[model samples]
Target: MSAAPEVKSADANDRANAISTIVLGFAADPMARWAWSDPSEYLRIMPRFVNAFGGRAFEYGTAYVTEGARAAALWLPPGVEPDEAEMDAIMEESLRPEIAGDIGAIMKGMAEHHPLEPHWYLPLIAADPTWIGQGLGTLLMKHALRRCDEEGIAAYLESSNPRNISLYERHGFKIVGRIQSGSSPVVTPMLRPAS
Candidate 1:
């Protein structure tokens, strides 16, 4: 059998590949589709959204990739956060006006459910569609959770796709609450307590 894929910190050189993996992984995701229903819009805006939402992982050396960027996880260390300003700007410019209120409510709910205490946040994790079912997701999760365990700090993530809840649970995460708004898909906020 081939050796298991090794997880490594993603550098700037890996940004495009890593982000593309996430984009393709989320193509069928309910929350993502609800936000950008048009295939063209999704293709155009998702890259910016990924960068705004989890790009810090790249700068902080917390972005992990494996199998030649076939899978990626963007984890924000304690006190680090998404670029809210850029995210807001992107949404304001790209989202359909009719769904603006729903989007706002969803964002508000996400913030309300977010843990106030410092924690590692996984804003995004995905494997290229063609690479699914190969343990890449579990590999990435274990690689990051190892650090969380070592530091005795909690880890948090919101599941944008219901299909992924079980995968996160398998890694020690528990659903703490849910976030939803008019015409929007449910977003499950999960937390893994410190070891």
Candidate 2:
């Protein structure tokens, strides 16, 4: 009923919240086929890679209360930084081990190309399934994109649910590629300009 909630800067501990929320958000999508539980899987692995991008990882939430908030969030790692081997280690040691994503090809491609360079990931932008149509995704995305503009960098993400394609388009992302992992479409790569 109210205008959702105010979006604000997230603290250090919010990174885990953001990652876990993303997994939960796509859990039901027939295309996602994601495999992970709430809290434990994401929280345990986030710290290992939170600082991977150096002094640029950020988390923002949309809630009156910080704690216990299913806040929509974004994770924008540093731009122009490269740590190829380090990123490989993060994926092998933490991300894949903790979150059971079926998209081996997606992970493999990420392993090939470094992710630390100028990009934003909407890793956790869910606001309770019941509240989905309330525009929380767009609100969170806008907040993330504004920061990306302030820093003059690009944003990237892969939408598992085809239904969300238009939603992403409205936010300046154009589908760059698509892939099928297993029986369902694994990921749809989208990029938003820094300009």
| Per-residue alpha-carbon lDDT of candidate 1 for residues 1-195, written as tens digits (9 for 90 to 100) | 988899999999999999999999999999999999999999999999999999999999999999689999999999998999999999999999989999999999888877898899999999999999999999999999999999999999999999999999999999999898888999999999999
- Name every residue pair that clashes in candidate 1: none
Model 1 ranges off by over 4 Å: none
Q: Candidate 2 regions off by >4 Å?
A: 1-4, 12-23, 31-68, 79-102, 110-117
**C-alpha TM-scores of all predictions:** 0.99, 0.63
Instruction: Quote the positional error of residue 111 for candidate 1 in Å.
Output: 0.9
Q: For each candidate, what is the lDDT?
A: 0.95, 0.56
Cα distance off (Å), candidate 1, residue 177: 0.8
- TM-score of candidate 1 versus the correct structure, residues matched by position: 0.99
